[model samples]
Target: MVTAAIGGERPVRDIVPGDHLCLTFADDAEQRPVVTEYLSAGLSRGERVLCFVDRTTPGIVLDWLASTGVDTGAALLGGRLRLVPAADSYLASGRFDAAAMVGTVRREVDASLAEGFSGLRICGEMSWAVRESVGTAELARYEREVDAVFAGRPVSAVCQYDARLFGPDQLEVLDGCHRGSVEPPPLRGHDSLRLVPAGRAGRRRLRVIGTVDDRTHDHFVAALDAVLHRPGDVVLDLSALDFIDVAGLRALANAAARLGGHRRMRLAHPAPVLCEVVRLLGWDRTPGLVLLPEGDVA
Candidate 1:
């Protein structure tokens, strides 16, 4: 199995050969280190690394890698690293063809394995799409095709998008397409949340982080609802979650009531705050909901 690190830590072992990851980063400076770390990790594990550079030129990227103490020269010389222009990758034949790009990606994966690499790791800078008028519909179709191409292949991909360039609607489409997303580290003592998509099965697993209050209620609801739409059970791992406001609590109750009978929801490793809220609301008896103790968390 292939594993990719989210936010420099949090190794997600659930990543299989055909998994596609979506990444939204603040800027090239903030994302360079993370990307370097990811590529470096793959190289260490004997995986072929393919990087598509758009906003950042090859020289700049190579310099960043060198700064990270990675032997970019040796990696290139060894045929373990393949760096190409992002526009070239996305605009093959002077047009963006989702089917063609997906086929090319699959071929690359197969070629990598045939060349003696254990697997293939791909990171594409998606800024080209934004500048080239790649419509939301087109990009979404491309993402879905990429996901399909990954199935049962020794290929792991991270498609990068700029948070500043893409609007919320486009970003949401991007997020919904990938199996998982790479999140940055949480603030030291601030309130925040991170959702990590588990797998492609009907079941969806999310790892919640930090606090959930009125400030984050909308996002919390959106995240929860996103998972509920999946085929089977929805598992919310709340072990790292610190707090939940009344609104957040109501969101959970609403989800439980809405999913009653038709679907199931699992609350794993509920913190003290969550446990108390559920108890106070008598949500322990909520239908179609299961609360697993910390030790029994799935």
Candidate 2:
């Protein structure tokens, strides 16, 4: 039940058991880096790593892992890592069956524990369902039912979706079915700060991770400015943000002022210090800024 919306390799490396994640990638360039980090982390932690592959063969996957510095050959030799074909699992019976897939996952979890591994980590490329014409209902059912297999258990799974292959409506449906998603790449990235687009079409959200201090304040302002131009209110998810200085706070205030009265910039789950600063400066009553407490939906 440890649900989270994560972005980048740093967060992917922190994924734990019982967390089911959805990863919708724009292309292989985005997908491969995250997958590589996931597999490497699981293997390093001594978990049984299972990857269901589509759009790439097992051999290519191994090669890619090796190139990315994963100890693929050793992990495979030790039987701690498995590269499964989508056909052999998701479409084994010539069509997708939600019950059958759930059962398969349950069995794998049991088998992994029996093998004395720390836990089971699984990731699957989900394009096969679309290719095979699996009904959306069936796909959603599989995602929901699979949760039972991981809930409170030593199992973590990530379901990968290709954004290019799935339509917006379909992607939104699939997104709602999972507890969390592996976010798309950052709008801006650096050692000090990473600003990622967490917003969907109608719901504009941005995640600010790491530190936003003097060094990164300009980048933050630039990124935030671009988001402010879009229609609708903006939500800044600061749950993962470690630090933000006065310069960063000024950028937020300026952005809110520019938005006027029509649009707002909502700060969701901001740090205590940030809240205090806003209150002390009377920015909390700023016309275009909204402060949301933790657990309050934007």
Candidate 3:
């Protein structure tokens, strides 16, 4: 039930342990926000993150991350964040050796788990491979072979390729080698679902932002399903939600019915409109549901 950030605030549940994904970007500017948000999600979930920087320097990466509100200094000093130069990591012997690099990453994942971290999240810049003229055949072989590295390990990685540098054929091969690809940026003015880790114990919070309606209830249902699958209590935060349609309300009511008998689901900070609807429908009296007030606004 692990999730990762794909389109900034949007969560992608397809990402899980032992998974490798492909991220194709037109430029660093386009990729910066996605990477920062993705890494921030890992840090918040107490996962160790390793980034291979080739398009930019480690200091620049840290600065960019800080601009996104991540405590870059704290994460780096605490050893939770590891920034490795792309050349040093992918070309340790002054050449691109996929087998060696895979081995190195496997060792790092092991060390991260041994250090008491939940899991490891890795990002590698593949522009260097293209610039270095790492033979297409060799690169393709490397991409295919690397998938085996995550067979049973608690590791998740994204191989970033510059779409402008790679051709259609090569990109197709790369795409096929990955378990999944980073989705396109979500359209503006749409709803977003964020999975926030609740600090108290191993609990989790699903924060719904923007409006949820028939057009977006699928996202809501997916988020709820992800949280409900985990053991223990869950919280749904609607403090930032502006609107919800009847379909969205029905989705929540159905989720409440699926909660474990002993476990409860807390709906916090609902909007004034939602509060009124809940009261009119007597949804507040539903078993396994706790609707909190004070989030209602006139």
Candidate 4:
């Protein structure tokens, strides 16, 4: 059934140029320079610019923004260049935590908005971010809320997304958000899951080369279950996977547990993103863990 709106038209633009500029970048590297260019231009115009993103590649954003070009010197002059949580991140990441991540931005941006200005020019990935309550039901809730940001301001919004990841269901969910033709990002490393032969006989590995969400997790879990029965190791390669919320992370931990009891459970090449989440939640202290060079060892 049609539970949400499809990618029809974007009726609102909440970004304002005088004070703030917000953008949702595609999940890659090259598009980031574009984001920085916008920031530099906004800063040059004495506007406060805040870019929204998840925890996967914080360094990528910072590095690109600080590089020469786009005139960020003015932003530094005015102390306007900042990185704030994209909208609805309050719900995505706890308020306290999100606030911590962008505290500097909050103080400066809030000051700008408070001083004879309009509202906040917030932006973020709007595909599946909802006002949530609890449980996996939250997944559905998030997939539904999409009110335009900077509701009443003279702002420009640019959203970058992956066409390959966009199926009918995902596109339909966008409903009324105006977007451009799909183009590949500069650093296109959004990899997919592939089965690789493991060392030794009868051992194959499952490598998810991109973000693993709840839905993907379910399928992965089932696939792992099927593979566990074979008398060999099924390694999970997480070098490319970026975003995984609490539930998804727990599911992987659980799967590892199961495999350990039966035969062998192994994870390899976890990017800093996965390792940080696992460490933040104290998963490292758990027993039967092998620490990979990248992530937890278990």
Candidate 5:
């Protein structure tokens, strides 16, 4: 984003790298421009960027990047970003091999370093769950690893932790490394069902929006059965869903089928991952899904 204020042409994607990261934003928005610019600049320096985002709405950060037309793949090492799924998903990890969320990011960092990605970016998005997980030891270790990664190569780790979620010390670490802060607009998610519609339309609109691990897949399946039982009119509002495991998705599919004769149930709010999963499993015909604004998909 170019600004007359900065008097410079800058890509929001490449603004900061090495301890002296500088992201220039308008006099209006507080710290966001600085934060994203730092991420871009850090990536330009060949340092993989790690963003600690609010897990609840982590997609917002990425969505913002897309809006800014930033090459996030270059900014992130995997060409795809990583996030710690919901806190509950992590809690369920013990029962599943590939399901358990990374308990401590330090271990994940160590493993990644050992694997030698040259440049790696890990973002623990801001969320209530992430804040609880960021204990003293975990926070300290994470910082140490960031320093270690930099020492090994010109690595620039950037995590956009929620100011509300983190304590002084945690913020200190991100800021200590000179990682700029980017605050998202207020979260846009329904906290709870204000009034679950029992009508046919309500039933069909409730989209299945979560992933399930092996152990929980059955549980998820069981719960979906109840939703399935709620008559054919219910809809699953999945628009905000981030991740739903294969088995989990399968369970939802089964739910849809079970209600096929009785009612027409469908999914809504499909993130990219959701679409991929739907296609991979050959369940692409959206039954009761809702489309984002027309211009969103392209």
Candidate 6:
């Protein structure tokens, strides 16, 4: 049940074992950063990483990792990183089989653990599924089955999808099979604010950095709206938020109230002023609005 913001390395870096993430990109320009960061993070954390390559060669993928300052040679030499060809793995036997693929992943995870690695991290380029031998329904089924394998296991996976190759309908179907999608780009406000989605302990979070006042109120609300659409309780990580006016605080309270049944909007580590306003206005008692103590935001 791990999830992440639509975009950014921070979110990807936060990915823990047992999380299955879907990443969609338009081209190599958009894909390189995310893929490299994900692999680098795993390697840094002592995890054995396996990257299944399609639409590119192993050499090229290695180069991409090297360019990101990764010690590619050392990682490969230590048996901590493997760049596999998709054809020899995912599409082996000349076609895709969901059960076989799931078993393959399970075996990989077990092998990594046996080898004394912290855990297993996988990144699969899924463009090969577009071949004639592969069926859309089978692709979706494989993703769903893989998700089951990842749950509560010492394995984390990211399925990379090329938006230019897959149609919107097919992409939507596949995206729904994973815990969450990693968007290609981050959402930016007009130089005043940035809202990034993140997850921790299976809870969805929106990291709000920068100010939230009259000028940036609309942007903040829009970002909040987008995050609210996600299933489960939402945590607004205002740890880095510089300032927030009363209007912004009210919006959070209102949103929490709207989410009435079991779902809550948690304001994590909000500024002192914001807390005072909530107490002064008696919004602290609002049913779904929770104000977390300073050190508890993370």
In order, candidate lDDTs are 0.72, 0.79, 0.71, 0.44, 0.43, 0.77
- Model 1: per-residue Cα lDDT at residue 239: 76
Between candidates 3 and 6, which one is better according to TM-score?
6
**Residue range 175-282, candidate 4, lDDT tens digits:** 223322112122222234333322211122455555556556665556555455444344666665566677766766666666655454567776676678788988
TM-scores, all candidates, are: 0.60, 0.64, 0.58, 0.36, 0.35, 0.61
Q: What's the candidate order when arranged by decreasing lDDT?
A: 2, 6, 1, 3, 4, 5
Instruction: Score residue 266 of candidate 2 by CA lDDT.
Output: 86
Residue 252 CA error for candidate 2 (Å)?
Answer: 22
Runs of candidate 4 with Cα error greater than 4 angstroms are 1-30, 70-77, 85-89, 92-111, 116-149, 159-168, 178-298
Candidate 2 to truth, TM: 0.64
lDDT of 5 by residue, 171-224 (tens): 555444333333222211233211121111011133333344654455555545
Q: Where does the lowest 10-residue lDDT sum fall in candidate 5?
A: 195-204
lDDT of 3: 0.71
Which candidate leads the pack in lDDT?
2
Candidate 1 lDDT over residue span 1-298, tens digit each: 5543332212233345666877765445336655777777787788899998888778877887788777889999999888999667878678788888888887888788888888888989888888888898999998888787776777888787776577655777777788767654222222477665443212225678878886777778887775454444567777777788878877887887788566667888887766777889898787877777672534
Model 6 regions more than 4 Å off: 1-10, 187-298
Q: What's the best-to-worst order under TM-score?
A: 2, 6, 1, 3, 4, 5
Model 1 segments more than 4 A misplaced: 2-16, 187-298
For every candidate, C-alpha RMSD to the true structure in Å = 10.7, 8.1, 15.7, 16.4, 18.6, 11.1
